[model samples]
Target: MFVSRLLDFQKTRYARFMNHRVPSNCRYQPTEYEHAANCATHAFWILPSILGSSILYILSDDQWETISAWIYGFGLSSLFIVSTIFHTISWKKRHLRTVEHCLHMFDRMVIYFFIAASYAPWLNLRELGPWASHMRWIIWIMASVGTVYVFFFHERSFGGRDAGAGMREQGRAAMTCFFHMVAPNGKQKAPGVSPKPQTPDSELAAPRPG
Candidate 1:
């Protein structure tokens, strides 16, 4: 009877703790069965890109272009690899929980590297035009700054300190510009028209003035 009451007390305490607010990073979902599954899922997603891109990069006739391609491919791939490894390292062993938390921060650090790597190649590409040289220097500088900022931010954020006023803002504008440049119809189609301008359905239904 005493044991049952103690068990109930423990359960109640756990329930209360879980119901209480916790930081997102602290609330990791690496509970048992999902640990290996998380790793496997990410591995399967990343491995093919790594293998296929590596082969393509090796065979590309223009080594110069391939360099940039490889950078883009590998930067994103490494994140998957790092995340897979971090998640795979379960904290069920109790002693490893501290290590797992450390790895979580390490994973965030890699994100900074990946973000930088993704843009580093575009800096050297001649096709990017006159501003390419200038943007390259700017990107590298911001990346360096963002990396340091993000690493420290994640550390404090994980420690339950909400001091992330400007967590990893550097290089973001450049990255956004790069993405827009690559996207279809990145420019304004016409003044006052949306990027994906669709004429009114009513106009289509009615006879054209022309």
Candidate 2:
């Protein structure tokens, strides 16, 4: 009888999960279990991300490389940490509106920094022409502008937007970064000269002296 009752409960929980629908408005009030699950998604990665960042920092060969690694590491780890904290608070302390709102704002702000840091290693470590070099600094400037926008205008601008608008914003940002990263550097190889093959690691590693 106990086993049968447990099976029925499991079926009911599964049904609720399957029937869940996202509201039209941007405000999503997840159930306690959903909030815990969301928190776990980011919290579980915090340790591994930190360990990976530490490894990259230790593997860095120069001062600039170390700095890039540190930037990337901080961005990656902070994203997860902040997300975990925010979601945990949302789950465990739903009544704390003021604290939750502050954390929520911080959570959004960190994402811009994280995006810029993701590009840092590749931009700083790779050998590039003048255009790409300029982008190295430009990306940070863009991130700063984005962070400022989020801080000063996010609530006022996007507080009433629907889920689709939020998705479109994310898509636009991703496309912008993609084009910047893949844009031509205006360098042409000599006739009959083969370019060196590039691996993922090579793209992020500091350029070796020729």
Candidate 3:
């Protein structure tokens, strides 16, 4: 029974993740779109620890100041590059505000994690003594604040009225054109762009004679 309940809970969580509709206003460029998603959905949580630990191992000295500076610079540069690429493509594509907002949230969260982890070791170093005591609190506070912001900032538009719906409509138009190019008789035109459905008068109420 316990195993069954756990499986049920996992199914429910997966459903929630999958069903969360990306706001319709978002226009997705295939490249940057995938990059942003990979960063947010997978790498954001893992990369910081990996990079930070690697940096620590490579450095000859374990001094907090030097390590922190290197980590900060590396973190900022990496995030800035990603943000720049994502924003540039998004702007050119005229993506919806919701997409832009979501991207920003993703970037901020990654940066937040990087910054927090970079200082975490300092909070634990024995030599730091009294200062180390406050380090934990500071890191916790910063992380807490960032998490709250990300949760509150996550917003997206969906459905027919969203800004990106026009782009989707255009995509539908292009797909129809492509179909026509490959197969002149193809019936794959946009739904409403095609002829209206016809029904027998018996299937509808007949108009009264004038």
Best by TM-score: 2
Candidate 3 runs further than 4 Å off: 1-56, 60-78, 121-126, 153-210
**lDDT tens per residue, model 1, 17-45:** 32334475666444354565666788887
Q: What are the models' TM-scores?
A: 0.57, 0.67, 0.34
Q: Which of the two candidates, 2 or 3, achieves a greater lDDT against the reference?
A: 2
- TM-score, model 1 to reference: 0.57
Count of steric clashes across candidates, in order: 0, 0, 2
In model 3, pairs of residues that clash are: 23-157, 24-157
- Estimate the Cα RMSD of every predicted model relative to the unseen true structure: 11.0, 10.1, 28.2
Candidate 2: list runs displaced more than 4 Å: 1-15, 18-26, 155-210
Kindly report which residue pairs in candidate 1 clash with one another.
none
Per-residue lDDT of 1-210 in model 3, one digit per residue for the tens? 878777663267455333333444553333444455654654354466456646655662435545455655465556655566445545454457677666666665655655554444433332332333455455546555654655564334434233224333333332332222222344322211334587988857877679
User: Against the hidden true structure, what lDDT does model 1 obtain?
Assistant: 0.60
Model 2: per-residue Cα lDDT at residue 71: 96
- Relative to the true structure, candidate 2 reaches a TM of 0.67
